[model samples]
Target: MEIYNDHKKLFTAALCLFLLLTFFVAIGPAFTSQNNNAPLPGSKPLSSLQTEGKAVFIAEGCVACHTQQVRNVEMDKVWGPRPNVAADYANITRTDVWRNTATLMGSERTGPDLTNIGTRQPGDDWHYLHLFNPRSVVSQSVMPSYEWLFDIKDYAWPNDVVVNVPDDFKKGISGKIVASHKAMALVAYLKSLKEVTLPDGKPVPLFLYGKTAAEKAGGATSKGAGTKSGPDGEALYATNCQSCHQGNGEGLVGAFPALKGSKVVLDDNAELQVTIIMKGYNGRVSEGYGEMPPVGTNNNLKPEEVAAIVNHERSSWGNNSKKVTVDDVKKIIASFDKPASVAAKK
Candidate 1:
């Protein structure tokens, strides 16, 4: 009887310990959930178009070739933003596609990271051209063309000239359209990419705050309206903009213009400065050697950062102008959607 009682007590103790361990293990994720800063679902939910496109991406076996994650050390420096966290995957649940399996979490970088491709390359026209023929833009591209994915009819030219055959499209099995609505949806999904902001509600390198010009300039007495300034502006310039523009703001002659004494920088009208920053400059028809690619393509910059940097550039390097504000940047972005005549007037 004594032996039986001891065994029973031992069994009960073991069972209680097991239950307690399991309870803590189960609730572990809840406690750690705050640390997992996942991305929110995009402003536009996964539409039927995007859903179909995702199906196409899966069917085409593109995941086998391409990856979405960006590692910390390997490609992070060049790519600007690094691999996403569990929080970045939160929005995936909203799409009903939690990508938990076969995710691009491997070490090998077979292709570029697609984490922020959508935000990095925002222009639809650029995407369309690249998809139609990769070699057209990227001279050393090794990827196969998906010309079949696109419909020649859908891409009618400006003059209503229906060109039945696109020049780059190679003949395939029965010449069936491979570029379906799914392809576009996939593109939409890709384009929706954006870099996760820092805890302070700004991008990693740049910091922004609401300040008048007077406050920024150390309470200088004379000014039309107060402007914003801080050390972030100078730091941002050094990290990103300095390489091309050079340290002293004297750009490569006949390539990048000298910011130190440029008419555009000193202009009283801040619109020109805002326009050039947002749209960028192509010197193809002009005198400069290479096009000034859009810096926003980096996808790490917020609208306010862009404004701050522009404001900094205009006000610094021996140039001075009315400070550019976040509101000003928002206004310029809105102007992009307006009619050409209205934009020109603005």
Candidate 2:
């Protein structure tokens, strides 16, 4: 009874209670979560270079401006095909033994969400140029140039990776731009950020408030929702092709070739257009424009999604051409068992 009445004893008892609660409520849950949340099915661990690049991503304060999450909202639809889920981030590993950046869900969206950037713009050249100088690709971008990641070489060695910077952004530097090892690693990290597919039969949480942009585009979800229509071509183009092709379909002068009134775009042979979208086209790489990536394969873009994109391109930018159906695009995808790699095609 005397001990209970003592101030020191009471204070000690209160402190013990607080610690007990903390252990049970916070610490216990953390350990349990670690045990429960294994990496989602089919999630790939980051490669060594990508892990190094992730450290670079954190070191450069990229997290301050950019985000990795896509919130479940109608507006955020522009950032990704579907809203982000816990499973999407279940595979995050520590940056190193010394420190863990944890998941780079980020603090805010000062730039854009990088959830599906790998799928959205898979072009290696585009990423390289953008990293070196944001304004090179996006004229109105406010991102500072990371020119330190590159070097100006009088002539690149055969094995060296030469960056074909646009003349205007080159600032009269006479040498070809060679990417440093760190730069290559950083680009590899960015390219490896593809969206993982959910296992079959799992119901997706629909984005709140309205019909999806895909729905508006006369398309449905990639998961086979609203299969009566194709996916939204305009949205898909904006996500996957707009950076290189530009919003108006007129590509960057001297960098990317213009798609407005393009002969291939206007051609009746939708097969060529579909093949280019799926397998990528480098036929014009010799003309200074860079090679396109196999966006469809990389992103796992479905037949309906590909058709929708083709339709949007064929109809947009004052170019009117035949629009292929989902079935047509499916046939095109099936025909090419082998990759139409830029090296092989060129």
Candidate 3:
């Protein structure tokens, strides 16, 4: 009894038991469950560029502020189409080379969740601008600018992809600021962080893992509000387009062209507008606004959603032009061979 009750022996036994409990109850289950889960239907492994970008993401400590996981909660509906599940990350494993950690499921959300940033905001210009200077796009963003990942080029060659920074953000540098290879890779990695959606009626549902209090009250509904029906035009525009084009339809001066009172919005025909929105435009429509990538292509927007967005633009800002129907958008999309410049001709 004296030996069994010795303070050192008792302490050692308790410590060993604690370690065993932690392994079996916490660590062991996590590894077992992760290995057991099948890869979700649409989950794609990160490409080489994306893998390097993921390395950059880790090196930059982006995980400290942004969380990758989207909890099954009512408030989290704003971040993604559905709650994230363990199976969503089933394919993430150790790499043979470098053997860096694959899981980036962060805990803090000082920044917004990025599980669906690729689908939500895929604009290259916006991302470049934001990375160069967060406050340039988001007036009150607390995020620090990653200006180190860019280079000031005195003269851009024909093929050099120069980041188009507005004159206001250009801090007296005469040269154009272009994204470095690392910056491009990082952007690619960020854009690759898409949410995985499993096929319906799979053996196990992802929603079963992360149910919020509100979701639990409603029998653990994981589906967010945006996926109920067809895409909501106002919501879609707000998420994808409104950053460049202001809320009032008046875009930034000399940066983004004003949608309000624009000739295209008030045009008799909606063909140009539809085409420009789908394919993108790179002409000097307004001073300093030289390039506009295909918004639809970036976001992978559907014809119906594009139709709704076009109709919204035409009707809003007191410009009561003809409302574009889905069929009209469908016809334009079917004739994808139309060159952007040819269709953009006003």
TM-score of 3: 0.71
**lDDT at residue 232 of model 3 (Cα atoms):** 62
RMSD of each: 10.9, 5.2, 7.5
lDDT of 1 by residue, 82-139 (tens): 4455655555533446643333343445556666666555544345445656553443
Best by TM-score: 2
TM-score of each: 0.50, 0.79, 0.71
Q: lDDT at 217 for candidate 3?
A: 53
TM-score of 2: 0.79
lDDT of 2 at 277: 77
| Candidate 2 local distance difference test against the native | 0.80
Better of 1 and 3 by lDDT: 3
Over 4 Å off in model 3, which ranges?
Answer: 1-35, 95-99, 200-233, 252-256, 278-308, 325-346
